[model samples]
Target chain A: MSILEFSNVSFSNEGKSILKNLNIRIESRDYISIVGPSGSGKSTFLKLCNNLISPSEGNISFNNKNVSEYNPIELRKEIAYCFQMPHLFGDTVMDNLSFPFKIRNKKVDMDRIKYLFSLFSMDEEFIDEKVLNLSGGEKQRIALMRTLMFTPEVLLLDEVTSALDSENTLIVENIINKLNNEGSTVLWVTHNDEQSIKYANKLLTLENGEIKSLEVLK
Target chain B: MNSGATLSTSSLIIASSLVLISLFFSYYQKLNLEKETIIGVIRAIVQLTIVGYLLNFIFGLKNPFFTTLLLLFMTTNASFNASKRGKGIKNGFLISFIAIGIGAFITLFILVVSGAIKYEPYQIIPIGGMIISNAMVAIGLCYKQLLSNFKNKREEVETKLALGADILPSSIEIIRDAIKTGMLPTIDSMKTLGIVALPGMMTGLILAGTSPIEAVKFQILVTFMMLSTTSIASFLACYLAYKGFFNGRKQLI
Candidate 1:
């Protein structure tokens, strides 16, 4: 069975169509990179996968069950959604990072946090710094680290590295690639065409809310 | 210069002419408010005269049933007016009604139980009017604050939701801030009470032959009641109303 499937899904907001007739079957560990012009519904497609927004018509199933059937909190946790512009709340970085563990009633593992910091080339001591004083690149990385507090089954990234410098972008891309190699289904949306094809096994193009093409690159 | 404790009917009529000075100024200044000022003056006299007679009759009867009915009537009217501020929230009228009703009931119950005021028509009617009207204002402020916070902090709340937090936990910060916003005005007013100006009820009591000390004591009780009612109403209204900002999918509306 496919890990995620959208069967004839259509979405419209305020009576204007945004996405229509999106049919796709995602397999486990399949890294799918989506590329399109702005307003081609790339971000909308990623949001649908995380159950952040439901289809106005048709069905979306996660793990062979209708996505609506799973509790929204549980579905969002399993299919993590990282936004284009990162927003880090609370006073300190640790406040944002430990939120995932706080919600799940689980103890946060400092070792896992330190390990992610090492991968992202961030100092472990930066966790104590105020979130407001962090640079844009640092904030995005910290936001992504918060999302990764528990490794998700599927990671939905919508232009997650848009603010990052080349060096930081490379760090994020490599870390996400590492997560993909470890059996996480990845659906990433990027405007940078070169970056889209650099890491993913398959590439999908969206045009005016419809899938223009899907190619298995690997 | 009447020596009567109450103003004579002719003296009251003479006092009514004070509005013409307002009308003369409006006309002289080309403010275009002469008509409105005359209409407002006429309406005040008519409305207050009617209410005065009505209260006199009601106070004479001292019927608990009528007193409760009048309190409910005031609360319903207040709830309707307050709900107008809650434009975005679904079923705003119902939420305002419940919050204001509960706040008024809890405050009035305590006042009556403590013998601060009787359940009589004269005492409860005035006290209930003050509590319900204050609750209405507080609820309006809470609704506005909640709507603003949800709009301004959409991304922040969604960030929490996307990380698996439920709606309540996601909205807790906004809710607390909104309640604080609703209650802050009452707290500030209490700080400036006697120094800033004489409050309406205390001034009225002193002018109506109550001792200044007695009026001051009543004002203190009322100041305390306002603080209690506003906080309770704001807290309840915020909890009930925050859900309106989100949909069943746990997404912000």
Candidate 2:
């Protein structure tokens, strides 16, 4: 069964059509890289999966149930979205890291956080560091780590590594790829063509709010 | 000592020349406010003259129906002004009316029931005007803060929303900030009540030959009621006005 599916979805914002009748399906563990022009609805497509903005026409389904039928909060938990521009929450890195647990009414998993810190090659003291002083690449990594705190079934990456240098990008990619191998579906959107084909098994290209091509890279 | 002190028409004419000083400053500084100063003075004279005769007639008549109608008119006018300042919020006038109306009503009800003031037109109209007017200003501040905060903090809010937060949780910080913004002025005024500036109502009573102690009593009453109404109004307005910024999909509009 497909983990996420969109059927005849059309989205319009402020009288301008963003995405038009997009039909998509992704199985569990599918690493799909989406490349598109700025306004070709790349971020909008990811947002729709999480029900951030509902389609004006047709329906989106997660786990074979209509997305709107599920509580939006619960659905968003399963489908975490990482934005293109990184914004750290509150003052310290601890705030963003503990937020996912706080929202779920669960205890913060310190050991798990420490484990994540090692994966990103960040020192443990960075937890208390103020995000205001963190570099853009560092902030982006923290934001991604925060999203992964709860281990969502689907991780929607909307150019999350855009701010990262090549070294940092490779570090983030390796970490995220490990998560993908563990059965978390990854739908990454990026403008870099080489990055699009580097790891993902599938590449989806969009132009003018319509899918231009889909290829199985593997 | 100054009770019944009246300004005759000729006396008023001489006093009116004081406005020329402001016009002179505007001319010297190139402020271009001469027209505004002239219009403001004329409007003040015209509006206050009408209100004075109307208040005199209404006070003498002692009709409860007229008093209630006048209070409603004032509340509606205050609501309109507050709503006009909030162009972004949908149904701003209706929201302001409900928030200010309820806040003013609760404060006035307590005052009337406690025998602090009578429901007569003389007392109720002025007291109601003060309460409703204060509520209007607080709600206007809340509206302005809500509009700006939602716009400026869009990424933070959406990040929370995308992280499985309900609208209230995602918007909680902004809502609290807006309520604080609305209520801060009243709290600051409370701190400096007697020390910084004499309140308009108390000063007027003193000018009209009321005893200093009596004027102080009324000022204290006004101060307490203003705090009560603004706290209630700011809370209600922030909670109610926030939903306007979110769409049915729970996305920030």
Candidate 3:
């Protein structure tokens, strides 16, 4: 079963088109990597899956139901997204990590957070540490952890590791790749050609707001 | 004691001599403010003269409808000017009008209900003017601050939404911050009321020959009124202004 399907989806802002007549199906557990030029609407394409942006034309369906039919907040929970430059709210790492649970009025799962932190090689003390004092790589890791804390059915990565060092990047890629193998579909957007080929089972190439080519890598 | 003393045209012109000092400074210092200072003084004279007669007429009539109409006009004018400060928010006039109107009306209603103020033109007009104008400033600050904060923290907000968080959870901190910025001036002014400088209400009442104790009482009431008005107005403005930053799809506009 497909987790996400975009059929003839096109989005335009002001007058310029961002994505034009995009057609794609993201099946369950498929690890897809999207590569494109800077302005080729890679981020916009990821946003469409969660309905962060409604298509100006055509339709998007998630789990066989039109995305427009689902409540956006609920839909977003099932399809988590992370951006290129991570933003951590509040003062401490706990604030960012516990937010997903906080919004749901659920208690924070300390064990889960600790395990995820250890997987990312984060120090146990870093959980209580202020986000303001963290390095860029640390902030990015925290952001990724926050997204994975909920364990969504699908994860959207918008060049989330772009600002990280190779070491941190590998940690992130390893975690995301592991999650993908664990039955969570992944739509990873990256500029690193080697990383895309290695992590993605299916590769999508976009140019000028449309898909130029798609290849089955593995 | 010179009780109920009034300024005649001759006395006013004598007072005008003080402004000449400013004109002189503008000339000697080459400040290039000579024309502006002269025009400002003249404009104040003309505007105040017109307002004096208008107030005299309104007071004599003692009609509730007329007083209410004038209050609305003042609120509208204030809202119009305040809305200009909110460049990023759409329909800022409506936002400011609702904020100021609610803050001023609720405060005025409380004062009237408690019999602290007589609902007469002379009592309500001045009190309402202060409340509405202060609320205007508060809302303006809120609108500007909210817009700027949201713009600056766009990534933060978008990141949360992308994480399946709703608008409120995403931007709650920024909302609180904007409200604080909006209320800062009023809070600071309240803190500095007697030590830093005397407020206008107390000074005016004293000049009008009201007892010092009475003047202090009214000043305290006005100060309290301002604090409440600013908080209410800024609160409303923050809620309304934050909406402008997001769309129906919950994306940042």
Best candidate, lDDT: 2
lDDT of 1 by residue, A1-218 (tens): 58999999999999999998999999889999999899999988988888778899999998999998899999999999888889999899999988898899889888988998998999999999999899988999999999998999999998989999999999999999999999899999998888999999999999999999999999
Reference-based TM-score of each model: 0.96, 0.91, 0.93
DockQ of candidate model 2:
0.67
Model 1: CAPRI class: medium
> Model 1: how far is B16 from its true place, Å?
1.5
Q: Name the best candidate (by TM-score).
A: 1
The CA lDDT of each predicted structure is 0.90, 0.91, 0.88
Q: What overall lDDT, based on C-alpha atoms, would model 3 receive against the true structure?
A: 0.88
TM-score of 3: 0.93
Alpha-carbon runs more than 4 Å astray in model 3: A163-168, B1-3, B28-30
Give the CA lDDT, 0 to 100, for residue B8 in model 1.
Answer: 90
lDDT of 3 by residue, B1-253 (tens): 1258576889878987999898899899999999998889879989988998999999999999999999999989988988898887888889888888888888998989998898899999899989888888888888878888887988888888888888888889899998999899999999998899788878888888988888888898999899999998899888877877888777778
Q: What is residue B130's positional error in candidate 3, in angstroms? A: 1.2
Indicate the TM-score of model 2.
0.91
Candidate 1's DockQ:
0.80
lDDT of 1 by residue, B173-227 (tens): 9999999988998999899999999999888888888888999999999998888
Clashing residue pairs for model 1 = none
lDDT of 3 at B191: 90
lDDT tens digits by residue: candidate 2, A5-75:
98999999999999999988888899999998888889999989998889999889999999988988999
lDDT of 1 at A133: 94
